[model samples]
Target: MAPYSVYVRAVRLALEEKGVAYRLDPVDVFAKDGPPASLLERQPFGRIPAFEHDGFRLYEAGAIERYVDEAFPGPALQPSAPRERARVNQLTSILDSYAYRTLVWDIYVERVSVPKQGRAPDEARIQTALPKAQLCLRAINDLMDDGPYLAGAALTLADLHAAPMFAYFTLAPEAEALLAEQPAIKAWWASMSRRPAVQATAYPA
Candidate 1:
C-alpha cells in the first residue's frame, strides 16, 4: 500500500474500479534498514505500488494503471476515441510531472510526514512551494471543461491519476485556498471523491 503514497492509491483505485481482487503489502521505503530485498528485486528503484500478477511484474504508476485497465475485464478506464485518450494522457502527465512534486513532496511531506516523524512542519518550504502548486492547479483548471470528470463526462485514467493527489493537497491549508479559486476543478474533485473506487482506495489520512 505504501501507506500514504498517492501513486499507490491511484493504482489501488484503478484495480478496485476494475473489480480486480488483490492483496496489499505495505512497504516502508524509509525504514532504518531500507526497503526489503524482495521489493528491490521487483522494482530496482524500490518504489511503491509495484505489481506482480501471474508472473507479470510491473512498476511505475502510469504503466501499471494502463496495464490494469487493459489486462483486466471491467469498465474501461480510458476512452475509445483517440482525442479523448490523448486528453486523459495529457492530464495524467500534468499531474505526474508538476502537481505530484509540489503537492506531495513539498507540502504533504513537510506538513504531514514531517510532523508524524516528530518534526515540525517546514513553513519556509511550504511558502516556497505554494505558488508553484497554485500554478499546477490553475493549469489543470484551464485544461478541464464543464464535464463531470477530467477527460470529459466519463471517469478515465486522468481522474484516477488526479484524485489521490488532490485528496492529499486538500489537507494543506495553503493548497486548499488555492484550490478554492478553481471552482471547476473543485467541482470535478467533489464528483471524483464520491466514486466507489475512490472511496475504497482513499489514502490513510
Candidate 2:
C-alpha cells in the first residue's frame, strides 16, 4: 500500500496506534496499465490496502482496521459502550459514504492535486462539491458536539478513519472557509493532527 493512499494511511494509523509491528508491502494501484496483478490477486477488486496477518487475508479498510484493533493486544480503538460504539460506526459510515468522495475527490483532488499534476482543475466540480462538503462537515460536527475527539471521551476508530481524509482535504485552499464554518471539526483536526500515529503516517512530500 502506498503512503499517499488515504485508506492505506488509515490502516497504518491503526497499526501505529495499536503499537503493532507490521510490514507495508507496496502496491501501485495507479499503474499506467491499471492496478498490478499482484494486488488484484489479494484484493480481487484492485484496492490499494489488501491486508494479511498470521496467514489470514482481508480487504476493505474498515474491516482491516477493526481486525487490527481487535486482534492486537493494545489500547482499545473501539468504545465498549453500546451507544458510543454505535456512534463510532455511524461516523465512519458517513465518512466512507459521503465525505470521502466530496472532500477528497471532488474538492481536494480537483483544487489541489489536479494542478500539481499539470492539469486544470474542474472548477464546476469543486463549486458543486462545496455545499456537499459543508453538509458533511456540519453533520460530523453536530455529532461531535462538545468533544475533544470525534467519538466521545476517548479516541476511537472514528478518529482514525476520518484523520487521513482530513489530512488531504485540509491542504486545499477551499478547506479554510469550509472548515471555519464548522469549528468543532476544525478543533478536532487541530488535536487529531498532533497524534503520533497521525504524524507518523503523514503523506510524503
Candidate 3:
C-alpha cells in the first residue's frame, strides 16, 4: 500500500481510528513494468492496499474498513443505529462513485499533480469536471443534517472515506470556489483535517 494512495490512506485511517496495529507494505501499481506478481497474488486487480488480518484477506477499501472496525476493540467507527449506519454507507458510496473520480482524478490530478510533473494541465478536462464536482459536493452537503461530521454527530467510516480525497481535492485551485458554495463540506474538512488519523495518513507535500 502506497502512502500516497487515497484508498490506501482510507484503510489506514480506519486502522488508526480503531487503534489497530498493522504494517503497510508498499506496492507500486504504476511501475513501468506493471504491477508486481506478488501484489497480483494478494489482489488480482493489482490495486493498492490489499489487506490481511488473522489470516483473513481482503481487497476493497470499504470492506477492509468495516472489517477493521468489527474485528478490533477500539472506539466504534460506525454507528449502531440502522438509519445512521445507512447514512454512513450512503456517504461512503457517494465518495466512491461520484466524488472520488470527479474531485480527485479529474480536478486534483489535472490541476495539481500534472502540473507538478511539468506537464500542462488539461484545461478542457478541468472545465468539464467542474460541474460534476460541484454536483458531488452538493449531494454530500444535502445529506448532512446538523453536524460536525458527514453522517451525523459521531465520526464514522464516511469521514474516513472522504478525508483522503478531500486532502488532495483541497490542493486544486478550483477547490476554494467549489467548497465555498458548499460550506458544510468545507467546515467538515476544517474539523476532519485536524484528526490524529487524518494527520497521520496525510499525503506528502
For model 3, what is the alpha-carbon lDDT of residue 155? 90
Candidate 1 wrongly placed segments (more than 4 Å): none
Cα lDDT computed for each candidate against the true fold: 0.86, 0.93, 0.92
Each prediction's TM-score against the native?
A: 0.93, 0.98, 0.98
lDDT of 2 by residue, 4-32 (tens): 99999999999999999989898788899
Error of 3 at 88 (Å): 0.7
Shift in Å, residue 150, candidate 3? 0.3
Q: Candidate 2 lDDT (Cα, whole model)? A: 0.93
**Higher lDDT: candidate 1 or 2?**
2
Candidate 2 is scored at a TM of: 0.98
Each prediction's RMSD over C-alphas, in Å, is 1.5, 0.8, 0.9
